[model samples]
Target chain A: MSTLLECKGLFKSYSGRPALKNVNLAIESGHIVGLLGPNGSGKTTLIKLINGLLTPTQGELYINQNPVGVESKKIVSYLPDHTYLDMNLKVRDIISYFMDFYEDFDEKKAYDMLSKLRINPGDKLNTMSKGTKEKVQLILVMSRRAKLYVLDEPIAGVDPAARDYILDIILSNYEEDATILISTHLIADIENILDQVIFLKHGEISLISSVDDIRSGQGKSVDALFREVFRC
Target chain B: MLGKYMKHEFKETGKLMIPLNLVILVFTLLGMVMLGSRLLSTPAMALIGIASLTLYILTLFAIFIVVYVYFTVRFYKTMYQSQGYLTHTLPLSTGSIVNTKVFVSLFWVTVTVVFTTLSIIALVYTAMGQEWGKMAVDSDISFLKELLFSFLLPCFSLTILGCLEQLLMIYASLAIGQLFRQYRVLASIGTFFVFYIALQILGTLTMFFTQFFSMDRLFHISENISGDSFIPFYRQLFSVSTIEVIVFCIVFYILCYWLTDKKLNLE
Candidate 1:
């Protein structure tokens, strides 16, 4: 498999404090990789760097061997942890906005997902419940035919059922050749869907291995290993 | 992509601006009717007329506030707030984004100015009637033309340039403020005051330099000129101010674009 993302000595700092220290990583295509870390472990910072939202203080990152720019943005569908959408816009309006900007955006797929959730396209975003808003955001992100989908805490604020639904949507969406990098602290919820997991601790990658490898070698699930490794 | 960005911006801002313009139009028309009609001349109707006049004034004030606040808030919220997540991720350069906003802001500012000017003209015409026409014709045609070319045209252009400068200044301040790890809004406000003071100092220096270097020459030329040649004098004054405004605008635009492009911290 070809590498979809590569980070070379990536480091990010804010206000004289390091958010991400020197970290090198390579993610290949066709696998779901869990970026598991506790709060402020630099998971979101890494995702933000990948999406070109935040600039790195040192080193470089690349998607498809290209630095983050318009070309890389074209292929990366990002769902931020917060609601980045305008609340005044209707669901259809937001979808059309995505369609206008992203050539890879699949409008029919987005609408179909919305319909499956019984969400009216005419409904304004501010009127929707928090879970519904998150679903809409996820639907929009998933509806893109992007090469990499960076989801930052996708199931953080939702209930267990909604989490499953979101994960299911994520699982069903995207091409098999594409990669999904899910950043979350809810390891147990997403552990089953991940093929490989990268444990990030205090701005560095603590471990990166396949779930089967961890299962056979460590005689435990990925979540159990994460708990042991990140025990407070 | 810039076109797409502009289209989205227009769609979002138009929802508020179009209705505000309509309200201004409605109030203008109502005020015209109240002032022109003879039915409101009675003592009892005087109270109604006063209320109408007050409401009209309030509406006009509201238009100014709305236009100014809308552009400021939109720039801050869309590019720096949570919405920045969506904005910065788009496959477009920071220049394109800022350009779209500046263009949209110019459009709304022009609309507001035009609306206000037309409303004032309508109100004057409604009150003064044929006297306004007489005053227009009684004025020297050549002198009026020169006044328009020198004074009014430059003033209009200066106003437009000033609007662009203000928007860019706000954008630059917001960009600078984003560097702060906390209290970004406070930082933005503080930056604005700093920029304001810098602008004032620049203004004072420009005035001092212009007067020190050219005031004597300008006065000598004015003394040699014939009847009512103040148009050239005003034009020269406005030209210098216009250049100053344009320079400030370019500097602010560069500051805003550079910071937004490189030092973006959308935390």
Candidate 2:
């Protein structure tokens, strides 16, 4: 698979403090990669950098050989940790809004997903519960046939049952060649689906290996290694 | 992409702006009906009429204020707040994003100001009845007035330029504010006041310096301080006020765009 994303010596600093330090990484197409890290390990910061939502304080980052920019953003679908949509807008309006900007956005697919979720298209986002809103956001992101999907903390703020539903939807969605980089602290729940896991610790990558390799060589599950590595 | 951005921008803002305009239209209609009819001749109706008149004036002022506040807040929310996560991720250039905002803001500001001015005129016409015609016939200024040069044209240009500058200024402040690690909203508000006060002080100093230079003052042409001084005075107006406003607009616009495009630090 081709390299879908590349970050070279990436550094992000807030004031004088570093969030991501000298991180060199590449993500290939057609895999679900788990970016496993503890809190403040810079997963969201890295995701934001990839999405062109934040500029790098130093070094280079690219999507499909192009720098983070309008061109790069075209093929990257980002689901922020927060509820990032306008709550005042109707779900239908937001779907149309997605349709308006993204050429790859599937309007029919969006509506279909909304209907299946028993979500009313005419309902304003603010009226929905947070779980419903997150589902709507997931539907919107997955409806796009983007080259790379970067979901930041997709299951962080949800109940266990909803987490399974979200995970199921994420697994079923997307094309064969598309890659997904899911950032989460929850390991055991997602390690089953992950082809590769990158363990980040304190603004640095502690490990980057295939889950199978870790299981065979390390004599432990990816979750077990994550616990041992990040056992502060 | 610019078109799509503008379309969404319009859709987002139109929800509030459209109803606000409708209220103005409905109020103007009501005002015309009440003022043009004998209803206000009754004591209670006259008292109610007075209240409605006050309300209409307040509505006119509120239109401008609401448009400014709503557009500014919308810009902040969408471009800098959590919603910014979605916005900055769009497959669109920063140029498109910022330009779309600039045009939508300009469109709303111009529309509200125009509507307010026209509504005020309509109310005045209704209030005056035949007095408008009488005044038009009696006034020397009406005939002698170069409508294009002195009154209508300049007012229209000034209104547009003024609104553009204000909108861009607020946008620039919001853009600058997002650079801070915390208290971004408070920072944005502070930035706006800093820009405002600096501009005010600079303007006063410019006036002082211009007077020091014995340049033809801004008031000279409008005040009719001298005879047949029209062309020279307007030349100075265009050179001075028009250029000054345009410079501020361009500066604020560029500051807003460049900072948003290059220096964005969305938390």
Best by lDDT: 1
What tens-digit string does per-residue lDDT give for candidate 1 at A22-107?
Answer: 88999999999999999999999999899887899999999999998888999999999989999988999889899999999998
What CA RMSD would candidate 2 show?
A: 2.5
Against the native chain B, each candidate's TM-score is 0.90, 0.88
- In model 2 chain B, the worst 10-residue window by lDDT is B230-239
Provide DockQ values for all models, in the order shown.
0.87, 0.85
**Clashing residue pairs in candidate 2, if any?**
none
**Model 2 whole-model lDDT (C-alpha atoms):** 0.87
Off-target runs (Cα >4 Å) in candidate 2 are: B38-49, B135-145, B212-227, B230-235
How much does each candidate deviate at the interface, measured as C-alpha RMSD after superposition?
0.8, 0.9
State TM-scores per candidate: 0.95, 0.93
